[model samples]
Target chain A: MSEAFSGPVAGHVPVLRLGDVLMVTLQGDLHDSTAQQLQQDLAETITHSGATGVIIDISGVEIVDSFLGRVLAEIAAQASLLAARTVVVGMRPAVAITLVELGLTLPGLRTALSTEVAMDLLTQGAPRVGVRRESP
Target chain B: MPEHTAEETHGSPTHEVRDFLRRRREQIAQRWADEPLFRSVFTVSRDEAVEAGKAVVDALAEVADAGRVDDPDAAGFSGVREQLARMGVARGRAGLTAAQVSSELATLRQPVENLLLSDIGEAPAEHVRACATTLTVLMGTLRVVVMQTALSEGEALIDRQRLQLLEVATPVIKLWDGIVAVPLIGTLDSARSQVVMETLLQSIVEQQARFAILDITGVPTVDTLVAQHLMKTVAAARLMGAECIVSGIRPAIAQTIVHLGLDLGTVITRAGLADALKYALHQLGADIVGPTANGTGHR
Candidate 1:
C-alpha cells in the first residue's frame, strides 16, 4: 500500500483502458503492496474512465497466494458495486489448483479461459447467471 | 578337528567364507535346488533352479570377499535381489508366514555348513566357530535383503495398480459442443478425487466447455469428506471459467449428506446424468422433445 500512497510510481503493472473496458494483465510474482495499489487503481479507473467491464489476465502468474486471491475477489466486488462487470481470464492450471487448495474460491468473481472469451462475455449484456443489477 | 585348511593360515572370516563358497559352489547349488524355495520357483526344470542357485552362491562369495556380507546394500546382493523378491512373494502367496520363509532359508545353510565341516579338516574349535558365525551372518543379511526388496516391490505393484484403476475410473467425455461429463465409479478417495478434479478441469480447457458434469452414479457412498471434495471440484471448475454440476447423487446419499450437515449449496447438483444433461442443454437454450402423432413433429 506504499504503492497506493506513491501513486503509480512503481507502475510496472499497467491497467489499460480498451474501448471503455479496463484490461489488467498480472505478470510474474506480484508484491502484496502492488496488488493493493492495483485494487485501488482499478476502483478509481472504473469510476473515472466510465469503463463498463474489467478483464484481469493471469496466465503469466504461476502462483496465487490467498492474499492475491482475496485481492482478485475484492477487485471484482469493487467493480460490481461501480456497475462494471469483471471477467478474470487466462488463469493457469497450477494457479487454479493452488487457489482451490487454499480454499479461496473467489465466490463472486467470473473467470474465462481466454481473453477473447472474456471480452465476448464482457460485451454481452445480461445473458447468463450471476448478472447483478443496481438497486433503485 | 584341528583348525587348519591347506590354504588356511589364520585368515579373516571374510577370506575363509569366500574360499569355502568358491570351492563348494556347485555342491551347495545342487543341494539348494532340492530345497523348497528353489524347487517351487524352478518347477519347470531342475537345471534352471541349479543355475539360479549358482548365481546366488557367486553373489554370496563376492559379498564375503568384499567383507560386506552383513550389509544389505552389499553390491553382491543386487544381482539376486530381484529373483529373491519373487521367491519371497511366491512364498507369501503360498501362505507361508515371514518367519516360516526365514526358517526355510535357514535350511539352505545346513548343506553349506556340512561341506564346511569336511573342508576344514582338523580345524580348531575357535577358528571353525568363527567361520560358521560368518556364514550365519551372511545368510541373515540375505534374509533382510529379500524382505526389504519384497516389501518395496509390493508397494510399487500397488502404486501401478492404483494408476491403472484411476485410468479406468475417471474419463472425461464430451457431451455437447461446449459441455463435458465425468462419470466417477467406486469410492472417492483423496487421491482419486484430486484426479477427478484435474481431469474435469483439463477437459473443460481442451474442449472449451462452458459446463462440466461430474456424475457419481456408480460411487457407492457420500461422506462429509467426499461432499467437500465435490464442492472443491465445482469451485475449481468455476475458477477455470466453467460451471460444474454434480449429478447422480443417490437419494439415500443425499439424505445422508443433509443429515451430516454438509453445505452443498455452493454445488449445483442434478438427480442423474439425464437431468444434468437436460439442465446443461436448457442452460444452453437447447432441449429434447419427443415426436408428435404424425411423425411430422421430430424437430
Candidate 2:
C-alpha cells in the first residue's frame, strides 16, 4: 500500500497502475527538468501498462508556471496518442485561476474534482450522462 | 481709560515701535486703503476696505507693543496668527488665489515700513532695523498659515475620489436565483483585490447564491499575482458555501497558462460566461432547453 510512496527523493514521480487506469499524483514544487522527466515517465508507464486512462492529482503543487503547464498538457496529449484519456484531478482553486490567467487552456485535457470522480468518469461510457433538463 | 497697570508694560510691547504705529494708525490705514490692489482684489466697499486695513494695522501694533519681536514663537504671535488666519479664510471664501493672499500680506509691509522709517525719524538705527525685521517675520508666518489650510481642503477631495473608484471597480451582479457573477475589469492590484473579495463574499451571503462566476474577460493580463487574487476570491466563496467558476478563458490566455506551466487543479473553468452559467445551472439541476432544439416555437 505505502510501497508506492517509497522512491528516490528527487527525480521521482509516483505512477500507480490500477486496473486499466494509471494514477499519478504530483506533489511539491516541480522544477522544469523534473517536470520534463515526469512527462517521459508517464508516457513510458502508459505504454508498458497499456492503461486506458490517466489521472493526475496536483493538489500539492502551489505554483504552476508556463513550463509546468506545458508539461501537464504534453502528458495529456501523449496519453491520448496511446488511446488513453487523461483526467487531471485535485487542482486547487488558486491553481486553476492562475493557469487560465496565464493563458493556457490545456486543450483536450479533461478535468475532474477528485480521484474518485476521475475514476468514476473513466468507468462511465460517455461524458457523464445523467438527468439533464432543458430550459424552455 | 483703565489704569496702565504693570501687566500692560509686560504683557504688551509698550515699546517705542508700538507707540509709533498706534499714534499713526489712521495714517497707515489711509495708505493701505489708497493701494489699488487691495481695493480691487478685496472687491469690498471703500468703508469695508478701510475697516479691514484698520484691523490688520491694529493687530500689528498690538504685537509690537507686547515686546515679543525677539521671539516669533512667543504667545503674542498666536493672536496675530489667529487674526490673519481669519482674514485668509474670508479671502478664500471670496475666491481669492494664494497669490493674492500673499501679495496682500506683502502690501502691508510698505505702509508699516514707511511709517516706522519716516514717522519715527531720529530713532536709533538698530531699533529701526528690529522693528522692520519683526514686521517681516510676522507677515511671513501668516502667509504659511493660509496655504496650509488650503492644502488640507484639497487632500480631502482626493480622498473622496479614491473611495469612489474602489466602489466602481467591484460590482457583483445577480444573474439568476442562485447565481451571482463578478465581472472584473482593469488591473487587479492588492487594494482592488481586497474590495473584490469583500464584495463577492457579502453578495454570496446576502443573495445566498450557490454558484459564483468570476469573469475576468476584461482583465488585460493574467500574472502570478492576479492568479493569487482569484484563488483567494474562490476560497472565500467556498467558505461561504458557494462554488466559484472562473470564465472567459480566451485562447491566448489558455496558451499563456500552459506556457507558464501553472497547474490549476480541480477548480472548474469555462471559456465564456455562457458556458459557466450553463455549468452552474447544470450543477443546480436546472437546464436551459432551447426552444429551437425542439422546433416547437417555429411552428
> Which candidate comes out best when scored by lDDT?
1
Please give the range of 10 consecutive residues that has the lowest summed lDDT in model 2 chain B.
Answer: B5-14
lDDT of each: 0.86, 0.72
What would the TM-scores of all predictions be?
A: 0.88, 0.52
Q: Please, what are the lDDT tens digits per residue for candidate 2 over residues B124-236?
A: 45555665676676556545654664555556668989889989988999988778999999988988987887788677657767689999899888877888788767754
lDDT of 1 by residue, B76-117 (tens): 998999999988898888999988888888888888888887
RMSD of each: 5.0, 12.4
- Error of model 1, residue A68, in angstroms: 1.4
**Among these predicted structures, which one has the highest DockQ?**
1
Query: Could you give candidate 1's per-residue lDDT for residues A10-120 as a string of tens digits?
Result: 554798989979999988888887889899999999999999999999878888899999999999999999999999887766678779899888889989877877887
DockQ of 1: 0.31
Chain A TM-score per model, please list them: 0.84, 0.85
Q: What are the candidates' interface root-mean-square deviations?
A: 7.0, 8.6
State the local distance difference test value for candidate 2. 0.72
